[model samples]
Target chain A: MDLFINLAHGFSVALSPMNLLFCLIGALVGTLIGVLPGVGPVATIAMLLPITFGLPPVGALIMLAGIYYGAQYGGSTTSILVNIPGEASSVVTTLDGHQMARQGRAGPALAIAAIGSFIAGCVSTVLVAAVGAPLTKLALLFGPAEYFSLMVLGLVFAVVLAKGSVIKAVAMIMLGLLLSMVGSDIETGQSRMAFDVPELSDGIGFVVVAMGVFGFAEIIRNLENQSEETRSIVTSKVTGLMPTWPDLKASAGAITRGTIIGSILGILPGGGAVIAAFAAYTFEKKVSKDPSRFGRGAIEGVAAPESANNAAAQTSFIPLLTLGIPPNAVMALMVGAMTIHGIVPGPQVMTKQPDLFWGMIASMWLGNLMLVVINLPLVGVWVKLLQVPYRMMFPAILIFCNIGNYSINNAPFDVGMTAVFALVGYWLLKLDFEPAPMLLGFVLGPLMEENLRRAMLIARGDPMTFLYRPISATLLAIAVFLLVLAVLPMIRSKRDVVFVEGET
Target chain B: MSDGIQAPSGRSGGFRIRNQQDFYGGLVLVAVAAFALWASRDLPGMRGFAFGPGTAPRIFASILGALGLIVAVGGLVTDGPPVERVAVRGTALGAVLIAIFILVSNYATPITAGLGLRQYETVLAAIVVLLVTIAIARGADRGPLYVVAGTLVFAGTIRPLGLVLASFISIVVCAAATVEVRWRETILWAAGLTIFCALLFVYALNLPFNFWPRF
Candidate 1:
């Protein structure tokens, strides 16, 4: 079979001793950083960008890819144990995972997280093998307008799904768009907010803002709370290496459905892992025999989101590999890294580097296996990390904070900006202004501004063209429809929750 | 959205400078916008460079200032939820620690001179900051102040220390400063982590520069 032959070629490229070793190491670091509160995989991979400067591009990409997904697995660990979701995708996990922990069922919670992730990883890998080429072809239809519209839709969906006021969520998304535009104008090469600082010529780095806001701010907030009643969870003994037969059966079908659903969703521009996680949860809730079980500590709640997030993490690679468009921050950073290596991502990438493409894909399976093995044995270690007092652990996190901020360029100016932003982030956190949407604004703001300006210039400042251009107009139309409808879904959800609570 | 991070900003004074969150957010935005508007005098419209570099940032940052004002106004209009304020003691200590950060950050920039010496300056400053920070943390009634200050200072200095030294020291000192371990316990934890990172980053990973002396 062509699949077998191609996979064989892939394995040949992937199975080298050095490659295997790097895969394991990447998995280890990914998991470690995932356990650590502040730094996630995207920034870690970005921090290591310079290290890969001289290495072969294939090896570099393979390792970076490993770190990305491996962190996805590791992220769930903290969420399950400590109620701190290390990455955005894992936020849904905290709903039930932390609930299970408070009930002293932490062992089972962590086990399901690892097992669900592994199953989804395998299922997604198979999907990637079966449909990567075709999906890559499908992705060719998207242009800048499509990408922008898709982002708008995704943000609206996120706001729709977010557990907060709809007005605030919309405000957050708009805020995120605005914040993202704060740097230099990409098209016109105009400095948007650099203020003549050499370091800011590139704009505010997300890593600094994310770490400062989510990571540091979280710690500060936690410190202020007088609830000293953190109980130590004992999972030193794997009370259940295997999920009870009922547990396995309940999640098995959900995992399969989530993988399938996530695979298709991921191929769409802007539908990355976090979106996949939320979408899968929504799907599971809709199809559940008893929808009331969700949000109140349903095992399926954990299983579906975990599966979808990982599957989406893999499949989102379609656009990046095929058309060279990066739909998210991590992928954007990957684009920057690849551009540095002079290997343009597009159709020719697969052809010119069969070994690279196939090998990276093959390596993911092996990497997943390594993650399960390495992460499972280390679950007890991570659970114990929860026992480490905040007073003691806070300093070490700061050190990582410094290192991560510094590694962005080893420039003091970046460090200063991070502090400035951290203070700003802390203030926003206090004011009920969501920082995540601000980040979204920060990420997409510049792009949107650039594209808007370009369209204007092309039309000689004829603003009407934005509404008249077929592709752009359609996207804008869809964005408007979704934006307006975002709150409707929430009212439905609230009514459903109230009804469920009354019945229960 | 408050998620109980702050005891909802108290309704007292209706918008005191004491609310550090909106203060810095507003102050920074207003200051930066003022600077941008001042600097824009140098740029021409539709110059050879498709659009001059300052054109977009000035406009964007100005909007940021306006947004900040809106956010601040919102804060001023609302009463924070009822909860015990984070001990003013903790907030005051935080301010003191931040003052230390500003001193080091504003001064350390010129001191580094952008030479290779920047690494040493960053590391040494981080060390001194870490020690003083930890001492303050342990000695003061305030909690986690040292860790926050140390982190802020290190984040402030990291760019000067190349990735290797900065990351290594930042992790080492911050971990040392924050973790609630016995001195003997911390020394081992700190030394072991430092050595392990040194080997992994320097020897095995082969990143340039040997930060700690190898005897």
Candidate 2:
């Protein structure tokens, strides 16, 4: 009954004319940027952060949620139409989505993807509402030791699930921690490693690092592969906008299973939409009677992953809202946004700011609905946008990023730092190091340090307090077990197979 | 440890690097760790139970150093793909062009005055601009050098030159990054983009931005 009342209040806030307008604007801009060749959601959201600066906290957060869904839908569109996944979550979609395009069933494939994503969104939004309260209750049980241990588990999950060498990933995490240690200390107010730069005293802006690493680096990389083959688009006409009954029937079970898998994985500390999509597609293949049909225009292939990714994207918010821990890089960006608005995310968010909390959850449903409604008829428009040459597009992106970074705090130094990080990003790419884990580590660094310090103080400097606490001990044990599982030769080989199969 | 011992006896001679990517990547990490250590050396460390600012950094840096060593050693023992080749000519050209732009923008006015050639300042600037464009047009496969140069220009000029000129210059420069650029088309596009951004940011969004140069 209380949930109903709260949800009703949430609807009232979300349905306000101004908030609705913001939501629409965010979705439109997010899709516009997301459909471009090389700009992923991380870069897209980072580039668009300035637009939300003046809005009320509720509207700002609601619009950000809208942008997230829109960017995801845009990524799926690119995957189906261009054989180029806009981001990693959509990579699996390219296999069957692009194949379906070649077979001239692009309309049905797209319609089914939207349908599956909507259903999954509907299911997971309810799941988020239902599970949110209990999780907040659980979060209340956590002490400083548990918080530290949980973050450690989250980092381990990121390293384990992330592709590439584990040791290198761990090293990247340490580097990120060191980088985060720059600027003024919280307790002592003593500056650490700033070298007396005024900008460094505030520490590095999240937007600066994200725009530099993801946005600029991606443009540089796309330029490197500027050969004709990379940007080829399927120019076939998309005729039938509706999926047939048979197509719908084939995908129903896959959508359900995907939603279930996605919702569960999304709640995990480090598991996010990318892994959810991969797991769903893999699981669907294992369960299908005709697994051979997967890569060859199967409707279920488009349905399962799309549904799972959307579901996972929404559900990943659970950890962020309840535990004050961002599950992935995208969530890390949200934390940055939240901090900007003077709103701290955690259990207190639910109790102290019920309107903002519930409003964001309700707005997500509205955002997903808006994507389905606005995007279907606008498919032709998006296809036309994608037709714009990459040469033209990259410049506009570069300018937009420059304006966006500059607009944040109206600081030119941040813009210069973005250029520097772009070089760093390019270097990281050359070395084959993953930047995602490093981002996760950077976001968590200060929080983890604070918790560890508090925990130690409470235990009078005894490091064994982490082991003495049941919850903290359990979390650390899971992290260790995951590390061991990742390092085991048998499991490592299988993990490689999963990734390799997706590419082939 | 066993792999490290066996690496010397394997097909290649002693101490031959097997995976150059991790080897070099790990070495860089170690260097970064060392730098962090040096930077935080002044901050106080642990005082009894509580951390004193520098403890966490030092701890993380040490761990990074150790992890980097392990990775470097692993690269020595493990067989992995060699590092991919980086395109040198294009990137070098881009870096040089950016350096020239920075030098010209920062020092051109002062140097011309110092040489008592202040009357020829515009000529000098125009010549440098022509040289940059010609070099851009003539260079084979320039890649994305102009893109970086344009961003830095916007950062340096946005405040003093304001949004209009900054946007115009940035778009024009960025458009030249690609080899397929048609100059006339790019200029028209830049004009249009500048107007759109100016109106959207300044009027519609009500952001505080100067449309023209402050001077």
Among all candidates shown, the one with the greatest TM-score: 2
TM per prediction: 0.75, 0.93
Put down candidate 1 lDDT per residue, A1-504, tens digits, no spaces: 766677778888888988887788778777776675444555455445555555678787877877877778777877777676667778788887777666666666777777777787887777667676665565466544444454555455444444444454455555455455455556556665456666666767666665555556555554445245354444445455556788778888878877877777776644367777777888899999999888777788888888887878887776667755555556655665676567876556776878887888888788888887888878877666656665556555555455445544655555555555555554455554555555545555555555555555566656576566676677678767865675465444431321000000
Model 2 CA lDDT for position A338 = 94
Tens-digit lDDT track of model 1 for B53-123? 45454555566566566544434433434222443344445556666655664577666656545434544
**What is the model-wide C-alpha lDDT for candidate 1?**
0.60
For each candidate, give the TM-score of chain B.
0.54, 0.72
Q: Rate the local accuracy (lDDT) of all candidates.
A: 0.60, 0.81
Per-residue lDDT of model 2, residues A343-408, tens digit only? 888888999999899998888888888888999899999999999888788888888889878888
Candidate 2 chain A: worst-modelled 10 consecutive residues by lDDT? A495-504
DockQ of each model vs. true complex: 0.22, 0.53
TM-score result, candidate 2: 0.93
RMSD of 1: 6.7
